[model samples]
Target chain A: MNGSVLSARTLRNLLPALSLLVLLAAIFYLQPRAISYVGFNLMLNLAIPIAFATIAQMCVITVNDLDLSIGTYVGFVACIGATLLSGGIGALPFIKDLQASGALPATLPWIMNTPLAGVLVLLMGIGVYALLGALIHLRNLPSIVVTLGMSFVWLGLSVLVLPVPGGQAPGWIKSLMTLKTPFIPFPIIAAVVIAVAAHILIMKTSYGAVLRGAGGNPKAIERAGWSLLKVKMAMFALAGFFGMLAGLSLVGLTTSGDANIALRYTLLSIAGVILGGGEFVGGRISPIGAVIGAATLTLAGSFLSFMRIPPDWQIGAQGAILIIVLALRTLIDRAEKRR
Target chain B: MNAEPGFIRRLVAKPWLWAYVAAAAVWLVTILFTGGRGGGEVLTAAFTFATFSVIVGIGQLYVVTLGPGNVDLSIPATITLAGAVATKVMDTQDGLILVGLIVALACGVAVGCFNYALIIILRIPPIIATLSSSFLIQSTAIAYGRGIRIKPPAALADFTTAQVLGMPVLALCVIALAAVMEIVLRRTVYGRWVTAIGQNMRAARLAGVNVGRTRFTAYVMSAVFAGLCGYLLSGFSGGSSLSMGEEYLLTSIALVVIGGSSVAGGYSNVPGLWGAALFLFLVVTMLNTYGFGAGLRYLSTGLIIIAVIVAASARKATR
Candidate 1:
């Protein structure tokens, strides 16, 4: 009985990865050349940023919160990389767009040339996210409401900074995205590294347990002398850090910046978390599962097209998968309880 | 008898009062900026525009009042889909408006049913489920419309443009609906059941309320309302496109939340819904007159939503 129970736990943990492999195999069999290295590189190229964003979202969920602004926040961070850090503070034709009177002085080219400005603005955004955490905790504001509001602000700010989609990524980021390895593509390597890193930090550590416990039972954790507020701030900051990584990597990959680009990441990352077996109000999350989950969705997004179904039906099909998987999860839990 | 303080406390407690204040502020700005000349005309136009939002806002309020984190993200997409369904049903034929309306409602019910399945049977979170359904409806809408261009019927357009007593006829119809809903919410067992379920779901369930069904019907009603708006907007704007109903998602939420309906559920103010909707319309118009671009408009609207909702949050926290 002990051995069977252990195996059951192990199977539950590895389910997401196994499903992803099966999906990959099916794609390869359906399109033989899809097994090649170049094919995977092309297919999973965008998955890296998506994985990072999913991790960011997972961090927020670790504390039983949601960041509806994740997509727009990443877009804002990309604007910072593509504009402010790339050049002056107000450099993106803001003046040209202003037809009436007052304009911001454009005499700060020297200050804008350095990378520090980008770093500072990114820090400022993280700080804002931390403030949101504080406000949510103190005021009992719903994270969804706050983050939804923040999404508009971030998207609007992105447009204000850039005003258009044209911008240049810094030298380091461009090179980082293009880094080639012997047998594996850089994105695959990066995804593995991110997954391992997040797994170690979130799943295999004492602090991580404490962090997740705060989500599960905050009052009990507080009784045990843990400051829920600090944990909340740390999770949000971690989300901010990964969101910045997602934005930078996206800019490097696309080699351009558009405010509207990466808008899909919000819902995409949410689905990734759900696919990975995360829950809405619990600290129940898996980093490796999330990474695999992102990859699975990236491939599954095209499966309907493979079946000769209209591309329009693909989105509905995704919703169906989500509902089915969730139902399956519910069934699995019920069976476990019965056992 | 120091009832003055009691009255003051009561006034402060009404979440809907703030919405009226915000609307008044917007009206004051319009008067100041537009030199009081186009006040009647601008208000007439704003009223017409807000009438479209009210239809969506009422349904949104029901779903929102279902408690914390319960939102219907599928409404905008439903509107888009319903618009296409409306036009397709009409097929430029005369005297088929009722048939078109019925078809549009059927489309909404379909989407709402899907949302119900995801939330009830599957145990999916309401937000993510609705969001997923949103994308599904959006993609299907795109396919159905075949690149987002469908001309609305002329008869419907004529009705929407028709005015009664210096106000759009549609506005009066919506006000009548709100009045009816007000009565239902105040004097009916169904309304009490909804509020009780929203206030305390587990407790209500233990008390023998059908929590799932109540919430399900709310989603259904919201979709049907959005369907009505979509068909109307297709006529008002001369056509339906991929993004025709997109803006309503955020704006509808803004109206509902600002009107003092608690995001945490168990509270609603229907009159404030109309006020907040009109206020938002005027805000967009006033900003346009002030030469503020889309960025500023987005920024301000976002700030107001956060401000009003956060205040509600803060007040609830204190309680």
Candidate 2:
């Protein structure tokens, strides 16, 4: 392996990240103004939520599981946070705007401003995710079917919490989203931090070895005196935790909550995970790749809007990119194996 | 396991039994609560919707039978795209209905081929491949339907309700289609090839089963059936909308799983899909008739599905 020439093994690792840079360069070429600090934030502000959601999805994928309801569950957590941030249930929602504190009487006053309630709900959501893990493992059910059913449940719950999409996030979260500095955009900083933190936990740590082993070959890991159930539960709990963060960040960005606002995240996250050099049934995954993958997709979502392409074909353009990238990866793998 | 169902034969060996039990319970509960008033109409409505689900379920059943770790999340998007394309092609012309329907089926075949290329050629995971395709399909659907207001052709409406012997003709047609599928799945050479491949891919390949081709056909069939369902749905829905086919995605999978099809592949209870679809629709109708809240309906639907999965798995694990 010459210093200047990248070997095939390293090329496969670098391909996904390099692809992201190429996309950015192309954006600069076509729309220089879109690469500006203000432009980047505005375009990628929504992407932070997706990035976190992708990480959430990646957690499950690392364990050879898929979370079909990532978006819905995140939305559920966000709605809960939104409802609590509303301060209090002022009155019955049906009677008036529900913002009207004077509409109804004799109702048990519920405090919506309590961060403690938010914590409890977060725990509850995590519990649900863990339960899904148990169900999939103990029940021998398919993760796709279980999560698909759970999505409807989470969607229904989110709707019940916020009949209409209107709520303010916690003050700190709102500030976090708004923080500005004289240097690079906050989204870049946030994306880097998330990617690095996840990489360390998933790729560098000793326990991370166990987690990967659990997915890569469960029987071997079990033979080494590790409980598959515990590892899987941890993976799912991490996924749920990250899902909540995605939802909270989304609410922070939008300053509102709609049960269905994050619906697109479901597919986006799955796509992001795969695009990031992650496998479906293997323990193979890359945290840094997942972040870049999310960013790539987030930008792809707006490619048409930025290029003045018809909004109608915007979706098709994305599919084409995904197909091309995947095909490229396959070709690379074949070439690498042949040598 | 099918070789000898000596013990636990009643449960895992036959998923149809579970569907039958569920269907019976749902009907019994519906009649008990509705007091028999409008029972016939209710049954008709439930079965009609169930027919739509059954068509989609049949496609999904085929795909899921491909093997473990394989699924097609793109069906919802395909269905939506089909509706959009077919309706736009018809452009309110009753005579062009056949043309529109054919085009819809072709799109599905195209999508299926694309999925196969992604999974087989590119070696991408089925979940990601289908999902990406879905995104593409959905965007195309959105663009195609952006400004066009759909008016489901008059002939389609008539086709949906054209009755024979006082029974909804669409329902009977769906039954016949299911029968045809059952034959193709159980009696055909292709069917046996798929089953052998699913049971053990390497062994099937060793036996010269043309595993790739069989798997490819299964996915293509899935997309085509889903496309047909979408075209019919647009007619029943009176037009296409952005989210018209979203609900069918999960429900179709649920129907097949509950019908006793193995999510891991190799085995499927074809008619059990019909029972699962019927039971699911009946449960929703029963809940509605009882004035259950929307939240309760969704919650109960989820819980029941979970319960079924749990029960089925319990039997599976014991074996």
Scanning candidate 1 chain B in windows of ten residues, the lowest lDDT window is B146-155
Superposed model 2: Cα runs more than 4 Å off: A1-6, A85-113, B1-13, B164-166
lDDT of candidate 1 at residue A303, scale 0 to 100 = 62
The residue-by-residue lDDT of candidate 1 on B176-286, one tens digit each, is 998887676667877777888889989989999888788889899889999988888887787777788877887788788788887778888788888898888888888
Show pairs that collide, candidate 2: none
Q: Where does the lowest 10-residue lDDT sum fall in candidate 1 chain A?
A: A95-104
Kindly report which residue pairs in candidate 1 clash with one another.
none
TM-score on 0 to 1 scale for chain A of candidate 2: 0.92
- Model 2 lDDT per residue over A1-339, tens place: 353234766877887798788888878888899898997887778778889999999999888888888988888877866666444443224434543556455444456334666678778899889878877876657888788788878887877677778776777888998789568989988999999999999899999999988889999999999988889888999999899999989888887778888987888888788778888877999889889888888787566676788867765776777787888888878876666
Task: Give the DockQ-based CAPRI class for model 2.
Answer: medium
Worst 10 residues of 2 chain B by lDDT: B3-12
Off by over 4 Å in 1: A1-8, A95-109, A308-310, B1-12, B317-319
